[model samples]
Target chain A: MNSFQLLNGLTFAALLFVVASGFTLVFGLLRIVNLSHGALYLLGGYIGYSTATMTGSFGLGMLAAMLGVAAVGLVLDQGLLRFVRGQELRQVLLSLGVALVLNDVALVIWGGDSFTVPTPELLFGAVPVLDTFYPKYRLFVLGMGVLVFVLLWLLLNHTRLGALIRAGVDDPEMVEASGVNIRRVFVLTFLLGCALAGLGGVMGGAFLALYPSADAEILVFSLAVVVIGGRGSLVGAAIGAVMVGLLNTMGQVWFPELAYFVIFGPMAALLAFRPLGLLGRAV
Target chain B: MLQVEDIQAYYGEAHIVQGASLTVNAGEVVALLGRNGMGKTTLIRAIMGMAPPQLRSGRVRWQGQDLVGLKPHEIAARRIAIVPQGRRLFPSLTVVEHLTMVKSARATEGWTVERVFGLFPRLAERKGHRGNQLSGGERQMLAIGRALMLDPELILMDEPSEGLAPAMVQRVEEIVLDLKRTGLAILMVEQNLYSALTTADRIYVLETGRMVMETTGAAANADEAPLRRHLGI
Candidate 1:
């Protein structure tokens, strides 16, 4: 309704897009629901928190989170999920178990208390916007989101790897039969998706504190974004994130009692009309 | 050169390709002809190590090396490519993207994107069109062009003329002949009996997952009776 709410919606949507884009990609190419994505978020947040605290460099924390979380994702995919590659139900259950286990692991490491990444000194103030001032950090987050979108667009459009990913999304078997090492592509995609989730985790942790249940909350929001957007579409994920982010922020302000309903209502309506989602193809 | 020695592939428990065997010598176009559900496609997929029907027994050899346990891409890396049934073009990829997606790490002397474009001029004209947007004939051309991008020593084509017009079928035959002149081996599975007879140097008839007959294309074309009896056509 107001500028602050709009900014809040857009910034939150930016973070949601970062997380859900990765989620949707993994679903798109690797065909995994990857429920542990939230746990990866929480773990990355905790790792980033520690790194920032120890080294006093927010940049290091971001780098550490992305690399660390991607390593975990590599282990998850190559070690556990590879055995049950085509079994969707098994992957779901396995990733769910991993999520629960990682959630507890974070609990043991960071305890039940909430933690936040301190805003860097360079971004420690507010900037003036239309009719009001907004945190420079949030604006930076929005810029990062735009940068990611642009970079991904370029990668998918201009680069050979991007073409492979897009083609793999359409028909992976056909891509492989054309002499591409599709398994290598799958691993690269999973790593990139996990790394993005980690980056989103650090960014989200800075703005919204990270705690035990935060992982579940972020995971649910990401799942909503992916479902509304379509399983494997990048543009769909961005649009879906913005829609959900705006609705969520506006609903909490206008009608707190009906906030969840306000979000799910439109999503349910969209699903009833477009069962394959806005850009999804038949799986 | 490729050889399939007594491969038994199954879809879960349903045995689809039961003890089928065939071979394609270098520079030869071998056709596997059969009725619907006679496991022609299954044999092709089995050779490629695709699942369901899963390969339970036998060996697929390329250049004298066994390929039974290799991944589909690994098998493809051995200079073999598949133009699958239905074209299986990436519905989202444009014509040029399809050709470029095949990374040219192997023999650089073979087909390039430019060469493929030259080969299929229709594909060159509609270079920006997505796979789903192409006409059936154009889709077939693009599929063949995509396979050629790998510069494959051998190609596995499944029903290359399944739904083409008569003129398009003639175009496909010309392409097969053209590739053969370049010394490329091809293992084609086809439901269209006449199409196979035209492009194939040798033909094998499959009956209920078994190789019931093997004859030269010339012999089969000369006496269509035994081929017709085996094919039940």
Candidate 2:
């Protein structure tokens, strides 16, 4: 592929990584599929658009979106999800219901029109990349992805909370028996994951305009990323995101008619070969 | 101190721990001995507020606090810890991470990572190893060390010698004796009568979920016939 296609792939993968990282972590820790993740993304985008418009600050818009979605996630978990915590099928159905409700909410609030978050003046221009110039905002998104990956890596590797999350993933009962409030851990992780979803929404909004059904579309891509990467694995998500993102870009460029098949056909083959995913362990 | 009175636990429809009562005083080592499938592990799980032998009726009073309705973490915060059956180590986490993950309940100085290392030097050697990578003996040491890191006043250990070699079981006995010297109360469940006889100050024999016999470990060690008869071994 050409440099432009490559950059498109990398930047797109970066967005997928941000969205799917939280997706994987939540699944790893909570065992909740969180079908509303796409809804969260769309909601975050619209919230960002409004906030940025009202306050006239891109940064503030991003902040509002994250916090708002986090609050919503908290309510969803404590109010609804907790009732069916260990019932996997029920949680999935509940989240699907929530997602549908959220999609309607977005349509009611933001309507069916597509709108991009107005690019900040600072990031409006393009800069030199490997072989050509690229949009500075996309590059900024790339930087954000790298920063998030690094921060999450450090958090998981060097911090106590990270250890608890990893341990909880393995054996939550033992972690609790060791005297750590695993519920609090769950809440914190949920918030972090949701906030990232919000962040991804805003970032994706600015990169590609927000509209109806966007939630489902993003959700599908993220699901593909997680399934291919391995449920609940950070490095796996990163690799899967890149693979999906590049394939997506290549498909759109070369054979727009077969883009959907291009993205999912390989996933089907991979799943048939490795049902646990590339890096997933048996839960 | 821990007091368990009339704790009736069940697994679905199966009544596992039927009206079991026992106690472990502060600075004491108490072992519950039973044959396989006799509800020893279930009783421990009930005390820790774990599910799948849901506590139907029970009172596990630890440090004067009734443990009913408390989540497992809350019980842990009440200065209690558990070395669960099969080690139950986080397969992906390193040994040091396991020790460090515990948020000690007590404000005062207690078990630190360094002290745990000092107590189990082999754990120190395997500090960087993940839970799955450790040998059986090392996993047991790490499990015990992980419990101690909680700075708990009491520990509930389930099947500490279940899968260990005899040499490792001997090592576990030494560690239990060492822990007893630290004045930390322990409630241990074991099928290994010899290990229990060596380390426990007090022994309770469970027969089909009931406490059939209670005697000092010294007495039991002196006269294994009574304990063995109750255990049917």
Candidate 3:
């Protein structure tokens, strides 16, 4: 791939990392497949677009989108996920139902037309990179993705709270017996994961047009990222997203006829060799 | 000090521990001895507030406060730690991480990671090894070290010596004695009568979910017939 394509691939991978990281965290800690995560991402983009349009402030729109989706995540965890804990099938079914309802709700509110949040004026311009013009907003998204990764790594490895979370990821029962309030950890994880998805929605919406069915489309890609990265592994998710992002981007560039098959073929092959994905450990 | 007053615990509708009561004083080591399925674990579960052994009716008081409805984490925060049966270590975590995770609850000036390493030098050597990679004895040491990291005022050890080799059992006994010298109270449940009597200051014999006899370790060990009959040894 050319330097421009490589940079673009990296930028796309960064967004995928942010979105998939949360999915991995929830899956790793709670062992719950939160299907509504896609809906949260879609809702966040719509919220960001409307908020930015109303307030004429992109930053505020992103903030409002994050907080709103985080609140929604809290409600999902406390009001819905709590009741369906320990039953994987039930959680999937319930979350899928919620996702469908959320999609319809968004459609009713935002209508059928696609919407876009114009990139911030400062970041709207393009920067010269290796003789190719790269959108400044995409670079900003890449920077934010790296910042979030480092922050999350520090939070999970350095702090006492992070220790508790890591311990929960390893053995939740042991965490509970250690006198750490595991329920609070669960709620915090849920909110944090959803917040990341919301951020992804906003950034992604800015990059790609947002419509009512955007949730389903993003969900498929995010799920593919999670599967290739392995369940519950943040580093794995990041690595997997970069690999998949490169493959998907390069496939379209080099072999457009077999691009879709090329993207999923590696996932199928990886699963065949390691059912837990590239970095997943057997639970 | 701890007092379990007529605690009736059940697994669903099946009552496992019916009115079982016992006590452990500060710096003392007590043993809850019984045959399999005779409610020894049920009593421990009741005290720890673990599910299945629902505290149907009873009061578990430690330091003069009721522990009947407290969650397991609350019970641990209140200075009670349990080395559950089978040494339930986090299979993915290393020994060092296990100790570090629960270090928040460690008693000030007591049972630091250094101290735990001192107690179980084997764990120190295998600090980076995951739980599943360790032998049974090593896993047991890691479990003990994990509990010690909490710096609990009172520890409930369920079958710590179970399934360990004789050498490991001796090492565990020495550690128990050392913990007792440091003024940590312990309630141990054991199938190994000889090892239990060696470490425990007092013994509570259970039969079919009821406390049949309570005696000092010396007295119980002196009367081998009663010990053997109750334990089915």
Candidate 4:
């Protein structure tokens, strides 16, 4: 309806891209729908909040949250997920339990408090754009999202690890047969995805405010992002995030009562028709 | 050098590989001949530990070390690799990326990426092409080149000539012989009987997942009767 609303939509989309990319990457490589990703995201937010409060440095909080959650991802992958392997039902149940346990434990530690991470003083004010003022912190969120996109592109395309990831993504058995330690690849990819989700949590926590049920809330956004984007394509995630993010903001602006209804409509339609999303090969 | 003895593998309840045995000595090429659905592919899967046809009982030994129950990567690290059925090229990856994605696990000098390029100049010419962009012959060349990149002591080639043209099949046969000259052992499963007869040092026939006949390549090449009898070509 307005310029500010459109900017709000774009910023929201940027954050969604950062959050859902990890979920998509995990699905792409491991063929697992990690239900605990949302818990990990929430845990990162709390960790980022606590660490920033103690150190008075927001950057340190971001780093600690990423590393901390990545370690949990490794443990989850090695300790439990590895055992289940292709049993999709078992994987879902195990990850769901982990999510519930982590969220409950987080409630105990953080005590359901709602707070937002303080953007640095340099990014603490508003900037005028298109005859309107937008939060500088929101702009930073958009910038961080773009920065992540560029970094992921370089990592997936320009590096040796990226080649292995892509090759494994295409034909994992062949990669293993070609003499790669595929387990190492799996672990590394899991860690990368975890770190990304954690980074997204830090940003999301700052923007949306850290609070209880934030995990569940973001989980809904993430699942919708990936499903509408197609299961695991990075470009698909980016487009889907933008699509969902804009759709959410627009729905809230024009149709308040039917916001969520509109938000998930595209995903349902895609599943009924083109289940692979855009840019995805057939199942 | 490799020895696969009495390997009984299964795909769930279906007994796909029922007690098959074969061997490939050092610097030798052993052609495994069988009709379609005779468990030739499953035997290769069992050897590589892909495990759809789970190796229920088998003794696959290489240089006196047991290969049974080893993971695919472990088997590969011990200097064995597979070309795989259908080429199995990573469609999104470029030809050069396909070869460079894998490195030799053993601390030995075998085949390097450049060496592979020298062996298959066609691949070198199309090194920048994506796997899916390559022609069937090119896919086979890239697949073999990828297997060579692991610097394997023994390579398992499954249907490298399955869909190739006659000229390409001849090229593949020459490549196998060339690999043997460089002291790399090969176990090639081929439907093209002529390619196998020309390239292999020894030949073994499998029927219904069982090894039924064994003979030298020279003998098989000299006489079409055994080839005609076993394969009914």
TM-score for each model: 0.97, 0.97, 0.89, 0.97
How would you class the docking of model 3?
Answer: medium
Show the colliding residue pairs in model 2: none
Can you write out model 1's per-residue Cα lDDT over B127-229, one digit (the tens) per residue?
9989899999999999888888877888999999989999989989999999999999999999898888898999999989999999999998899999999
- Provide the RMSD of all predictions against the true structure, rounded to 1 decimal: 1.6, 1.7, 3.0, 1.9
Please identify which of the two predictions, 1 or 4, would achieve the higher DockQ against the true structure.
1
User: Between prediction 3 and prediction 4, which has the larger DockQ?
Assistant: 4
Model 2, CA-based lDDT: 0.90
- lDDT (Cα, tens digit) per residue for candidate 1, span A1-283: 9999899999999999999999999999889999999989888888899999999999999999999999999999989999998899999999999999999989998899988998799998899999889999999999888888888888878888888999988888888888888889999999999998898889999999999989888898898899999998999899989999999998999999999888889899999999877888884
User: Using DockQ as the measure, which candidate wins?
Assistant: 1
Give the poorly placed runs of model 1, Cα more than 4 Å off: B104-108
In model 2 chain A, the worst 10-residue window by lDDT is A170-179
- The lDDT per prediction is 0.90, 0.90, 0.86, 0.86
DockQ of each: 0.79, 0.77, 0.59, 0.75
Candidate 3 chain A lowest-lDDT run of ten: A157-166
Residue range A138-242, candidate 2, lDDT tens digits: 999999889999999999888888999988888888888888888999999999999999999999999888999988999999999999999889999999999
Q: After superposition, which runs of candidate 4 have C-alpha atoms over 4 Å from their true positions?
A: B104-109
How far is B166's C-alpha from truth in model 4 (Å)? 1.6
Candidate 3 lDDT by residue in tens digits, A16-83 = 88888888899888888888889999999998889988988888888988899999998888888889
Q: Counting only residues 3 or more apart in sequence or on different chains, how many pairs clash (N, Cα, C under 3 Å) in candidate 1?
A: 1
lDDT of 4 by residue, A39-73 (tens): 99989888888888889888998998999999999
Q: Tens digits of per-residue lDDT for model 2 on B142-179?
A: 99988888778888999899889999999999998888
Which residue runs of candidate 3 sit more than 4 Å off their true CA positions?
A1-4, A128-132, A250-260, B5-15, B36-38, B91-96, B105-141, B163-165, B207-213
